[model samples]
Structure formats: C-alpha cells, structure tokens
Target: MFHSPRPLVAAAAVPIAFGRAGVLRRPQPRFNLVVDLTQQPFSKRWWRGLATLTALVAGVSQLAPPLGALPAGTPVAEGSDQARQEAALAVGALSQGSATGLTMSEGPLARPIVSAPARQSRSLSLIVSPGDDLARLLGRNGVRVADALQAAALVRAEKALPAPGTTLSLRLGAPDGAGQRPIEHLQYRARLDLELVISGSDAGLTVERRQLGLDRTPLRIRGSVGGGLYWALRSAGASPTQAADYLQAIGGSLDVGSEVMPGDRFELVVAQAKSADGRTLSGGLLYAGLERSGGSDLSLVRVPLGGKLQWISETASPEPVRSGLLTPVAGPITSGFGGRMHPILRFIRMHKGVDYGAGWGAPIVAAADGQVIRAGWTGGYGRQVRIAHEGGLVTSYSHMSRIVAEGGFVRRGELIGYVGSSGLSTGPHLHYEVLKDGVPVNPLGVTMVSRPLVDNRLMAAVRARAKALRGL
Candidate 1:
C-alpha cells in the first residue's frame, strides 16, 4: 500500500513506483538549495574565501615554469628527447632574448655567402703607333704571344694592317691558369668605307669585312687669312689635304706665298663625305673665293667635264695665267742664281740655282705642273727631286728632309718635299733651279703661262651650276 508521502523538508528525499511489482521506480529528485547570501549575516566571510582561492591559483601559476620552458640541467622522460630539446631551446631563447645559435639584431637578415666566378672576357682599346704592326700592338696590350701571331697572320691574309694612328678595338679573354690572356676579337677600320672584324678562340680564327656607307653633306665656312693660307684654311676647319687641294685649284691665277696676305677674307664650300657613324671620310671643294684688300675677288667653281672635275671661274672670261712662277717655299732668297763663294770649299763657284732660307721640315711645293723625273739623294744637292714641266722646262728642288712625291704626275703648288739639309749644306734651305734641256737657267727670268679654258659647251654648264650654287 502507498502511504501518503511525507511532507517535504529542507534535507529530505522522495521516490515514486510505477509497476505492481515495483520493478520500475522513479529516481529521487535532487534539490540544489541556494540561500540569499546578501541577506545572510556571514556573507562577507563567503566572499573573502572566494577571493583567497583566486589569489592562490594566480600565485601558483606565476611560480611554476611554462610547459615548453625547462632549465638546462633539468631531468626529462626517456621517450621525450625532442620535447626536452624544444623546452631547452625555449628556455635559452627567454634567457638570452633570442633562440639558440641566433642573435637578435636590428638590421636586414643575413644572406648566404657565395664565391664569385672567374671573369670570362674583357674589352680594351689600343692606338696604333709608328712602327707598330698588328702582332706587336696586340702583344703590347697583354695578348698572348701565340694568339697575337695567329691573329695577325689571319688578318694579314684577309686585309692589310691598319695604318698608324688608327684605333683598334679588342676583346680579350680572361687569363687561363697559366696567366695567358688571348685576343678573342679585334676590330679596326680597313679603309674609309670598309672595316675588318676578326674573332677567334682556341679553336680557330674568323675574319669578316664590313662595308660602311657614306653620306655627303655640304659645308660652308669663311675666315680671314692669318699667318698664311694653310693656317687660315685650317683655322676655318679645313683638313690639311683640303687646304692643299684648295691652293692647287687656284694656283693657276694666285701665288699663294706672295699674294696671300694677312686679313685677306675668304669663303669656301665643300661636300664632305662621312661614314654612317659620323666619321669623316673625304671632302671635295665645290666652290672657293678670296677677296684681297685692294684686288678683285677671285672665285673658283668645280665643274664636271669629260668625266673629270675641273676648277673654273664663275664668269665666262677665260682664266688668266699666273704672272710668275708660284714660289716653292715661303722663305726669303738666301742665295741668288749666280756665282758665289762656296761656304765649305772657300772657293768661287757657279751656283746654279737660288736658295730660299727656311726652317727644317718646311713644306716645299712644285712651282708648276710637271712630272717627277728624279727623286733621290744627290751628292751636293742633298735629297733632290726634279720635275719636268711643259715646253722643255724643268725645275729642281734640293736639300729636303723628306721627298713626298717621288714619281708621279704632280700639279702646280703640289707638295713635293720638305726643306732639309741632308747633303752638303750649312743650314736648312731649299736650292731651287730652272733648267732648259738639262741646262740650268735663272728661274726669276722665265715667265709661266696658264692652260686654255674648257669647251664653250662645258663652260655653259659650269656657269649654270655656279648660278644655282650662288642662288642667283
């Protein structure tokens, strides 16, 4: 029988049955009784206990080491070697402010060190000097002897070596273990329009010739004659060859030595040929003019006729012949063409020609258009050169430092030699002579004539070209 349940009490338990046999019974329900601590008189003591417990937990955490932190000498479990190592590393990092085998720094991270490789190639430039051949020049610039010789042989087989003052660009290989750097590549100008490139290694050498195109551009310049015509032209940006050509063109009418004075104004126009890379190749005078102080202005224009270029006057009037022979050198007459007391022999002798006193190496030019018949050393005349002109006329120049035109058809005012005292001479001077049929004669007494003008048809074209050039 189920008796009435006892009245619920503060600490009492209660249960209920389900089946008649009491096989299923309900569990006693638990009661969590919470009192109002704020209302209790001992509530302050309870809060104090909680505070103390929290303080104790915090103090223990502070005193114990971290999980991954252990002292170096601390013992560890046998199967926890890795864990022990990690703990030791952590402990070291904390103590030293950095991990083991690493330092804390305030800069970029260090990179791995590496060894530099050996140099394979280098570039160098060499200027050709006098008496310098390809082999010698390369040898002087640190090229291996055998390699230089082989390269020189290859270059000579393909083309002539570059002239003096020519710059050669070279690529050199690094020195081997034997301390030998070989020429790997060589480049130099073969001609004004051609360049030679040579490249090789230990295997063999290769040669290549490259052609350079030229561009012709017009140039005009004006200046006053100072010191001389050559100096004046050079001052106005004319090359030595151009200045000589200009003088030769006007030689038929103007005497450069005596007529050209200081302050003489001049103007010139030329077509200059330059390589694609801006190197000057050659130049040709298209027009030239000179205005003397008290004389009429002289103008010359280059005109094409009979497949050749000729310098003619702008006007139709026939070109005038030069009054006298062009002086060979710009020097005073030191000895006249007559008998004189021989300075060395101390005897009266017949001096065949006149002597012009000049410094050594002064340029001596042909007095008229002629062909060189003799150019070599003569006993008393020193280094002599004889040129045969038209109408059985011949001129001789002696005492030269060097002969420029040995045997060639030379025009009037052409450089033939430089003044020198090679043979019997007291000082540097030019002994000039004029001969008729191999007999010496007085040069100052004879007169020179100019050549005839071109055909009238050619002259018409020349006049037209001059007009167009002058913008008339």
Candidate 2:
C-alpha cells in the first residue's frame, strides 16, 4: 500500500565540519552553520561554503606530486628502471646535481641525487664545394673563429687544402658552458698521394701528412676507329679531358669525321700519375696519332715550341695558295667601270664603279680581309659597306638591301651585305667599287695577288721537334 510520502523539511540542510584528515564531516547540532538546499536564492552561507570548497580542491591539487615523479621512499618496481629513467627525463629532473636541475624534495629521487646526463660531442661531415677554403668551411659549420683559424693554419703548415669536390670529415668538441665549440679533429685528402690531418691536443694543434708512393709515368692507349674516335678513346681508359684535348689537337688539321675511316688504328699517349694499386689519379693527353690503311698516317705530339708546349705534326703538308681577289658573287655585269650616261638623271655623268645584276637580297662577300670603315647610310649609295684592305686599298659594296658588317673586322669570303637597290638607282643590283689611296679604281681586269711560301727553316725545326717527341 502506497502511503503519502513524507514532505522534506525545508529547514533540514547538510552542515559543514572540518575533520582531522582535512575533509568535510557531519556537523553537530550545536553548530549554527548550515545551508538550506531547497532555497532558490542562496543566502550568504551558501556562497561562502561553495568558495571554501573550491579553494580546498585547488590547494590539494597544488600540493600533490606530478605523475612523472614519485613520493619519498617509494621503492621503484623491479624491471621498471628504463621507464622510470624516461619519466624522470620528461620532468627534466637530473639524477645528479646541476645548476639547472630541478629539486624534487620528497620524491623517490631526492634533490641533488639525480643522475647526470652524458655529454655528447657533435660532428659534421662536409664536402668541399667550389670557392670554399678549409677555414671558411669550418667557421661556417659553427666552429669558433679562432679555433678554426688555428686548425686550418696547422693543416696548411703541411699542405694547402684539397681541391674542390673533396669530402672532409670533422669532429667537434662538446660545447662549453658559454655555448662555443672547438675543432677536435679534421681530415681530408690534400693530394692524390697525400692526406692532411689536424688533431687538437692539450699542447696545441698538430698537423700530420700521410703520403703514399705513386707511379708517375706516361700511359699509352690504342684502339680502332670503328664508330667514333672520341668514344673509342673513352672506352680505352682515356678520361674525358684527355679525349677532348686529343680531338682539339688532331681534328684541327684532319677532318676526323670524314678523313678517319673505319678500322683505322689509333694510338694515344698521356701523362699519368697512378697509385700502387693500378688506379689512375691524374692524366692528360700528350700524343694523339692515327694510322690509316690506305692513306697518309698522321702523328701529332706535344713539344716545346715558341716558349710553350704545342701540338705539331711531323708529316704535315704545306697550305695551298689562296687568291687575293675572289668574286663577291657570280652574276652578269650589267654595267662596267668608268663614265656612262646616267640612267636616272638623263645626263652624262662619271660612273665610278661596275654594277652586277643579282637577285633581290643576294649575299655580298668581302674581297679581302679588312676592317669595315662604314656600314650605314651614305650620300647616294643607299646602304653601303666600305672595307679598308692592305696597302691603302679599300673595297666598297653599295646599293644593298641590308648592311650586316657594322664596325668591325670582316674576313674575305665572309658575307658583308645583301644586294639591293636601296640608295641610288636601278632595281636589285650591287654597285661594287675599289679605291687605291681614296681614289676610285677599275673593279674588273685587276691583277690577282698570290700567297707567299712557308720558310724552310721553320719547317725543319718543326720536323726535328716532332722526331724528338717520338724518340726516333
């Protein structure tokens, strides 16, 4: 049977009392402090009690130890040493005394009893780049300026730094309290047969050079010119430098691409410096030779000539004679040199040069190697090119569509301008003229000049040096 529930007494409230454990306990009847739980608007006592509970909770939390730490005399569980060490590190507590270490007064690890952290040395491995010296590289890597200079100087006492692209190893000492590191050890290859080492010591830095015996001899490489001479030389143990040097020396006289046939035997001798284990450390081409089965053999050797080493061939042929005057272009002479009736002016006038009937924009070449005196606009010649040759002689190409040589040297047979009726008259044609001492001369029926012969003494000296290089 459900009887009517007893009504809650409005005056009944849970009173607060402080106990020995600093916790809330039941209050006695004599205690006047009490709270009315059923009241909507809290009285002064409710607010005061809420504030007092919050303050008590915060105080308890502040006084409790962190999770990473332990209470005093708490024996660490067995086999949990590693975990404890990690936790201690997380809280930044040292196992030994340090100026910056935290003081855990009541934890399992007491103040001044934490273990000290091991000091670690720093190291850096660097590759020597282009434009980098030893001292600059070390200082850039965080070594003290003074220490870097000292170590670099010590290394230089034995030998200078290695060339670029060398790998260097450096070990730095642990930084001091002032946060400065010193170079402890440095090592790098100084040369093909020598190594430089700088080791720091209590006295000072000591430099040591370790050297190995190397065989410095001329190496010979021979092969067949089946496909390409350069690639064949590379496959026969010649470095790229040697192969390129060989081509520049040999290809200038002979067109290796066309003249050098397949199955032709080729020989190369180069300067080499090798270690004991048959490893080539340095080499360069000294002699490049080619023997053809059905043609003249070519042999070039490096010899001292004109105060410097130069490549010269013993079986070199003399250069062919070249004509001084070459026709600028092949076309019909529409007009001849000397005076004639002016086609545009309709009067008798002095026609100074000959005219050639050429296609529109036809190329015009220099008659002889000379400097271009004028290349832009002229009085009635439209666009003109004037070249001053040897012996006070000058050649001019006028009435051009465009001018190419602006104010520099132009060689014979080199294009100077294109034919056009730019300035004076007519259609597409070139008015060519030659002047001796600034006076106009006839362009046609002029005597051609011949090339000179090579000196007999120069040729004899060249042959002698070539034989010396071949040890004949």
Q: How good is model 1 by TM-score?
A: 0.57
TM-score of candidate 2 against the unseen true structure: 0.45
Q: Give all candidates' CA lDDT scores.
A: 0.79, 0.73
Which is the leading candidate under TM-score? 1
lDDT (tens digit, per residue) of candidate 2 on 326-424: 566546789888779988988988888889889998667777667899998897899999998777888888888898788876655566778888876
What are the runs in model 1 whose C-alpha is more than 4 Å off? 1-214, 275-278, 284-286, 302-310, 315-322, 437-439, 464-472
In candidate 2, the residue pairs with backbone N, CA or C atoms under 3 Å apart (3 or more residues apart, or in different chains) clash, namely: 94-114, 95-114, 95-115, 96-114, 96-115, 382-423
Candidate 2 clash figure, as a count: 6
